[model samples]
Target: MDFLNPNYKVRNLLVLNAAGFSCISLVVFLLATQPFYLSDVIGVPPEKVGSAIGTLGAVDELVAVIVAPLLGTLNDRINGWAWNHSRFPSGSRILELVSFSVLALSLLGYGQFATKLFPDLWFWRAIFAVGVSGCMSIVTVMLHEVNNSDFRWSHMAFWRTQFKNHGERLLDGNGELDTDNGGNNELPTVEDDVFRIEEGPTQQTNKKHGSLAALLGVSTGLGAVFSVLFFLTLPVRLSSWYPDLSSKESLQLSYTLLGYFSAVCGVVVVVFAYDCVKQRRLSGHTPDLELPDTTYFELLKQGLDASRNNLRIQLAYVAAFVSRSTAVATAVFIPLMVYKFYYNSGLCGAEDLQNSLKVRSDLPLKTSCYDGYIFLAILTGVAQTVALVSSPIWGILVDSKKLGSRATLAVASAFGMLGTFGLCLVGRGDVYDPRTATCFILVSLLGLSQIGTIIASMSIVSSVGQTVERTEHRVIGSISGLYSLCGGVGILVITIIGGRWSDHWVFGPFLLLGTFNAALAAVATRRG
Candidate 1:
């Protein structure tokens, strides 16, 4: 079958979208299950398990900072060669396929090796961390490829506008329309009326592109649902076939299977999916369009120079990264904290805790103190979906200059901080009864806060960058890497402190995290 047909670009996009969702799901699922698997299945102590997990975060952050920029630069230098080469040359697809294969193999090895080797806690954790980081890089490359595709530019512009609109609403719970006295209609100025006519075709094209993009969103959402279901069911299916296996062994087997499946899927997409499509287009009698050959250093210089022109862009990057770091801090130790302090509370005894841990070990799943973590995960997924869907809208609004990115970021940061504070207070209140309800509410609030922050930060980043004619792949990767690095720092701190004091003082870490997040929010808002 012809793989390189330009007409098949939409198909490639669907594949990329699905791959992106799958990659994220796999990362989050593994992360959520790691603590439980290490402590219960592998027989590592709770404290050590926390350290091991924290170390992974630390490693991922460090690697991201180092790798993203370099990889981005490489991507820039090899832009057309990697993406538009007529033949199967060393390009983005090759990098993506190799990285994904390594990631999947590493994960599978960790799962199977844990059963036999019982390697040092940190060793296994580091392997998984590095694997996920590699996968993240590949995903970023794929995102850039998708963005640069002919079909995606208009969609990106629309989403950018959507994101800005969402940011405005988040900042002040209203759309762009003015609330005039008695809600009377306002007449458009002569310039506004003339400009509207001039931009009519562009607006119509954007609307058409947006409608098509919504179909892709639907596909992505469905893919996520399927991926989650597959993960949830894999363990049960394996356990039924291997009933005599230990819980740990079963969990390891499940992860290994999933890893292998993900790797195979990634390889197929990189090889026969996108690359083939590109090649087919080249072989046809179609005219060879000029693809830009921008270097990474050039893009970096442009971004840097652009930031100099607009100080707000630089501040926006810092604010967004800092806010993201603070927001993610709670997740670092929450798993370990729940396991040590709340898992074996009055409701669930040591035996039940052990059994629950065992079950999770057999499957790629983890349940925290009250299984509230699952609820939290669901809420987070929903919020992220909302933010992703609204991104284009926000971008459009920013481009139109209806609202400022700084103001939007500040308000979102404030709301997120407030949510963290609320969670901290609830944790301090010592309310153990109705555990499910309380946990649900807390997680929901966190999800809401996260959604606001996600939208705001994305808007700010888009606003700060230059509109110069060049590929933005490297800049996006570098900024994302920096964000990951900050998150890693936060996770490292939480693991060190929370791991030591969780057993003796449960509330201390929560209180500290809340305070830290609030303080960071204050700093971000001031800078914004």
Candidate 2:
């Protein structure tokens, strides 16, 4: 529980991971809600709103593609060259703090612009995306390196063995192991007890890694909880904080607060986050090689080559691309969809204005709180709550069983497709009452799928990164950077097209989600 205790590495890791992911969730939550503000408060049309928001994200991704690799490679060099000189030998920790601050300021800048305290500029918002991507890149690399250690591997092996052995017994309908007698009769199954028998690259690499599922679950759960709470109470808090403020100003103030919180959290991480490289040095694992002279592009090329050749890596990347696109689209479009379909927009009167002032709607000066917006917030919160509850379970399955990323991703995709398709149907419904009930169920399912996709894809990337480190002798930072780079590409591809698509059809993004998830399922069926 005491993450500052250096002796408690697991606790430290759990806390650090959670804090890092929290920043990401906050940014994403803000982005998702911004569409409502743009359309309702700023008087932007739905089409333009989606397009503009998508463009903002696209700008971030474009920058991410450039920055992630460069920063990752730079970290490797810093670790090699400045290990003795730097305060935090890893360098990523400092970068993470800086990125978080950048993200925070960017959010504040957006708020300022919206509140007419600053000039309207796309550049400021784009900085937010860049900060997010950079933070993600650094945190991911740190996770890979810190996780790939001998102590962690032992933890994973112990749990995996216990789970696998117990599962085998359960399948055989017996409690005891077979000796001279034949094994208990069970369904035909292929079992890989390779971790027990062979010192393959996976086992070797895992020696440095801990229970990845557990780490991932705890981190993602924290993020989910934070996002849900922050967003759910945002309107109420904003309204309470500044009673006389206009709706735009109120919302902008809320975002500014988000930035402040994120920035403070980032400062904490910079001060207390563990230094994995220094820890390795203390453990007598000193690197003999000097910093690589390779250019950033060349290092990136190596990462790309490894991913291209590794089937599991390629599939993981693609699945992440699809899954993340779905998530981003959901965040940006779902509230807008609710506004279009479920809200009682016709109730725009003096009484409604007074009601809205009390409850708050997405639109400016609308005192009538749209039932749809509240419902969407609740739906989103419920889904995130489910994810927080289920993350640990999914994490255990991924780490302890032989389910692998492929099976996990396939299952997640099934849920994603079903939920998205259901949402599409719900959106098209003629009756609001029935649709409301169904919307809750579909959105909840989507949330579960979101967690599943995250855990599976993350596990795959971590495993692949370790493999590349061992077999290719490449820096895990560079490899992890590549994983993030691929994800950035996914965001770009979806947001650019999806924004336009949503403008045309209210259910277009949902349909697209269903189709993409279906494709993800197909591709993820490959060995991963």
Best by lDDT: 2
Residue 163 shift from truth in candidate 2, angstroms: 32
lDDT (Cα, 0-100) at 482 in candidate 1: 40
The residue-level lDDT of candidate 1 at 469 comes to 33
Task: Summarize candidate 1's per-residue lDDT along 325-399 as a digit string, tens digits.
Answer: 443443444444455444435432444666765654333332222243343345444544544455455334333
Query: Mind giving the per-residue lDDT tens digits that candidate 2 earns over 1-528?
Result: 111101114434555686656765775567656766665555565447666666766776788777776776666655554445534446667777878888888878766665321235356766776787778777766566445533234433333443445356333346554331211122322222312333333344432222464466557656755675666457556766666666566666777787788788788777666665555444344354323355556666777687778787777677767767766756766765655554334432435665755744443453434354466667666766777677776676666557756787888889898888887765664423424567777877787787787777766666643322253334556666776777778777777777677666666777877888898889977543
Tell me how far the alpha carbon of residue 320 in candidate 1 is from the true structure, in angstroms, after superposition: 5.1
TM-score of each: 0.66, 0.79
- In the order shown, the candidates' Cα RMSDs to the true structure are 13.0, 11.4
The TM-score measured for candidate 1 stands at: 0.66
